[model samples]
Target: MDDYQRLVVAQFFESLPNLSPELCHQFVLRHIVPALLPKTTSKVDVQPSAFQGSMSYTAILHIHSTHGGHRIVVQFRTEKQDLSGVTEASCIHGSIVPLVTYQGMYEELFVYTSPFAEGTPYISVLTSSDDFELPLWKKMAIVMDLADLVTRGARANNVPPDTAIVELTTTLDKTQHAVNDYAFQNISVRTSISACVSYVLSQLHNIVTLPLTLTHQDLSPFNYLIDLSTGNVKAVLDWDGALYLPVGSNFHFLDSLFGFMTLKGWQDADDRHELEAAFYDRALDSLAAQGYKGITKEKLELQKAIGMLLYGVERLLKSKDEHSEHYLDGYLRGLSFMKEPISSSY
Candidate 1:
């Protein structure tokens, strides 16, 4: 092959090493080039076959698409074979269980390669057989567990409740006041956010502190997988947002409340409203009962302000995709619930 042809051939081989020359070239021309090429290459149409495997308690499945050409999405399912005498459904992600096989304690949780895509490959339960769906109240219980987990975890890590609250608020307010066209990092929402948050921290200089624990900063439904049968949370996914040390306060409640609100917004005008309210109430009560003594009225008010700001910022950063926009809108409304000053009705 000439120099130009050789260069193209070498590049193609590097893209997908296992495939034969013809197949590699086909994959390249069909998926790679069109994706990488300037607005010139033609798009091809094809769907690749999917592969699946089953181990002791888990099953792995991977789906490929030659046309869409996204990353290989693999799914792991825990088969829970010992369901004979169990009163409730059993789940095994992020749990401290003894290892019975190659899937380590964490492996049972989830680990897979996902390069820029929605719905990363991961484990989920068999929803079809059990017809599993947690009622609103039960779901709220899970949210509360999450909130306490975060609050305790943060305090243990030496994050003063006040600082945590301030930073959290600043991040939110900055995001909300940001103009739509302005980019977030510079003229970004983070600017004003940092300022307000800084002021809050200055005011709450003396709060008792403890060592920090793990903070799952993004505890939204997208990252959490809930077991509907027992009202248990199976896994807390995506630690990418987790932070260590004292950033003042932990922002764990941010996500759970957002999740609660999204669910609330979807309720039917009549029945759904009541159900959603019950869910939110349960979660708030549960958080309060579980030692999440979030300072005073002023602190709580700041949390709401920052929380709303954060929501707006979050919404502004949302993708223009259909599903993304839909979810963002729901979460934004959820954030709204926290914005109001004290109200007799929750």
Candidate 2:
């Protein structure tokens, strides 16, 4: 390993102090190897790139490990001499939270929590050298699976079409309010269109309240996956921030899916031709069939607003010690997006 690689490995291990060399080796073999390096009948082509950083670069290492059954990936990089050492030292002393903390028993949350203890196979980044803090891939898988389960369950319960529309609306409202409240309390950021937010909020609020369900608080492209083979969702990542809120909360996953599709530039005229209202209508009907009482768009949007604000506050408060303003911009952006028209789709 070069100086950079050595530093990267050292920092990873230092963060995850509980990680023995054996476990680290296993992780590399089991997870990293599979994604970056898939089965090749002939010679395999491998490209190496470094994770960008101001003072350090992280390189991917493909090494066959003896501890695990398969190959593994070891990401190695170096940091600024001054910052790297300080950063590693912090990990050595910091307390770590296992993914287990998110586990629980419930119809909605159960699908998510059960997987962890049940050997829900996943790849995790060995941060804090602890067996917690899941890697992106594993987290994504869990959320996607839970989303599917929720959809299926809704259908089984005889949910109605309006339920999904209501939930989606409600979620947007919650998110907007959360962002506004947090910004006013902790920062000076304000939205330009107050009426837009109100209009959207009102559209959703008129919808009736429904039973609570499981919703991933933070859903984005990085959080989900779609299996090409089965045309089914392979996984939904990032459950650390998962919560059991109103029915609208469930729509958070949809926004993530839409965002992913949109970002990939998949929303072309041709793609739209393949997609019809039926695609969404059927899914929404399924949720209603599953017995979901639709939440008004207003309620869901408010909840989403609140959720965003809480998350923003969390980032600011946590980083206050370091005087980091990293998430402030994001907080403001999230609020701005919330105060928009409700007729806008996810």
Candidate 3:
């Protein structure tokens, strides 16, 4: 490592007394910097990454090279077991290769040696998306186009592998376990929420029997890059949580829209509901064109509700770790959605 990088590592070690300085420095030189900029001899600046609130070991660096400069975000794990799953997910770029060819979406992947002290293996580096301000309509259009592409591409290209299904079921089981273990102040409320989730999962079994697709399980607004001038999505970020799961996993799109509308100061709940319904209608029509069947307004609503519950419970589980009140609020809001009855007709 260079003088600047060494100094940074020394500072980091000072703050993290449990970590070894020699090992951390070795990780920076051998794995982190090289992964940040491959095959470069140019002067690069390494700073703390702008991305925050992540559970893993993360570093966002601004790199200056001979050609130009760009930002690189990195996530690593200290333990071998914790590193394996993320490493495997990072390497699975092939699943979304077709979708990246479509307009309004982009994907790039970089794999390098693992930064861990032992059991070192390959890890991934991805291009961080740019932040651009755009009109609400324009942003929604970009998101809809991306959702369509991901859904259709999975349909036309390949069937979901057995391993993918196994992973999905495993995650669902974990969510169930988390729900059962939830430490709510009211035992009756917790029981009711757990029962609701169970009912939804039972209903979802039939839906899972249908074809599966590569889905951006986390589709928040912050995960996308948009060209403000044209309002087109230039890139999509954070594929580590992506999965080959059942289609209509675009609930994150709605979650993002809710947040966006709130941020934009939309006061009327009816207006937000209209926008969401319109987006769902457009999405359903697009998927239909690609030969996806069995989608109805009621089913779509149920899917979104189940998705919200899963997301909330997952966040609730994490709140125990991060002690964030925001996660607790999200979990309660998700439970409220779970209480709604899934009707057959809209």
Candidate 4:
């Protein structure tokens, strides 16, 4: 491991005084190393990841075998937050494998029992994205390509009926409950807006029965690796959130919207609108090519608006701090669009 990586791991352990270093080392040797390496492997390097905002402890492992050397990222989650069910579902539903070989997406290498006897319960190893720098436009292209590939692949391959998709209705219902239960700082006005947004989304869900497809529910630009030099997408990361959803879910689009909004600040409305228009045009064309004929400009706008409102509500509900009112601004903006008739042409 590099000096920086060692320091990070040491700091992590230092923060947890009760945990023994020897036990942690043995845990890695016993469980992680074996699952990721060959018996003939002579050397291994483990380094703590520098990524932020993840709920799991992450590290990158370099393994050297007789054949060659390769790198893998390992993530460990607490028993209470164990992702075994999600991983198992991906495997059983045949979503993970095809994403790598058939769809040209990245591979989720392995999932194993965590070596930490307490607190942590499961560990997952996945292929690394190799960290290629990319510009905003390039990232947008990659997101569009991923959406197209997954939608087409789902239509071609008969995806099995999974409980995740079947439970989406229940999930939407819970989302409505979250909105109603949200203790807004301005409870009177915000609650009225929240209820209206929730009702609109529920109505859309009832009226539009779009064909389901494999969707990366969380499709932010950070979850992908793009080679800025060639404008090519090297890998699509983080399949833990992948599931079967409406073909034009717009999760990626919303991600791109909010991402650019943060980077450019909320004041640059023109550029944001331009990017949204371009993304929607490309998405509509791609879906049409895949024999999805029902999506008109009006329907596309409605879907995109609903996607924005849904994510905004989720953000507000998940926020634990007093900053929820700040998030409510986004929800209110989305609701305004839902109330008016949006232009079919961006």
Model 2 alpha-carbon miss at residue 298, Å: 7.4
TM-score of each: 0.41, 0.40, 0.57, 0.63
User: What is the per-residue lDDT of model 4 for residues 139-203, given as tens digits with 9 covering 90 to 100?
Assistant: 45654555454455334324333543345546566766766776666565365555544554444
Q: Model 3: per-residue lDDT, tens digit, 293-323?
A: 6676555555555565576666656665433
Model 1 global lDDT (CA atoms, 0 to 1): 0.37
TM-score of 1: 0.41
| Cα lDDT, all candidates | 0.37, 0.37, 0.47, 0.47
Q: Against the hidden true structure, what lDDT does model 2 obtain?
A: 0.37
Between prediction 3 and prediction 4, the one with superior TM-score is 4
Model 1, residue 210: distance off in Å is 11
TM-score for model 3?
A: 0.57
Candidate 2 clash figure, as a count: 57
Cα lDDT tens digits for candidate 1, 174-256 = 55454344453334234444444444444434332323344444444444445555545554444443444332233323433
Least well predicted 10-residue stretch by lDDT in candidate 2: 109-118
Q: Name the regions of candidate 4 deviating beyond 4 angstroms.
A: 1-17, 20-26, 35-38, 65-68, 79-136, 154-181, 186-207, 250-253, 257-270, 304-311, 320-325, 331-346
Off by over 4 Å in 1: 1-133, 156-177, 180-213, 245-308, 311-315, 321-346
Better of 2 and 3 by TM-score: 3
Distance (Å) between predicted and true CA of 228, model 2?
3.7
Note each model's CA RMSD in angstroms: 15.0, 14.5, 9.9, 8.8
Model 4 residue 232 lDDT score: 44
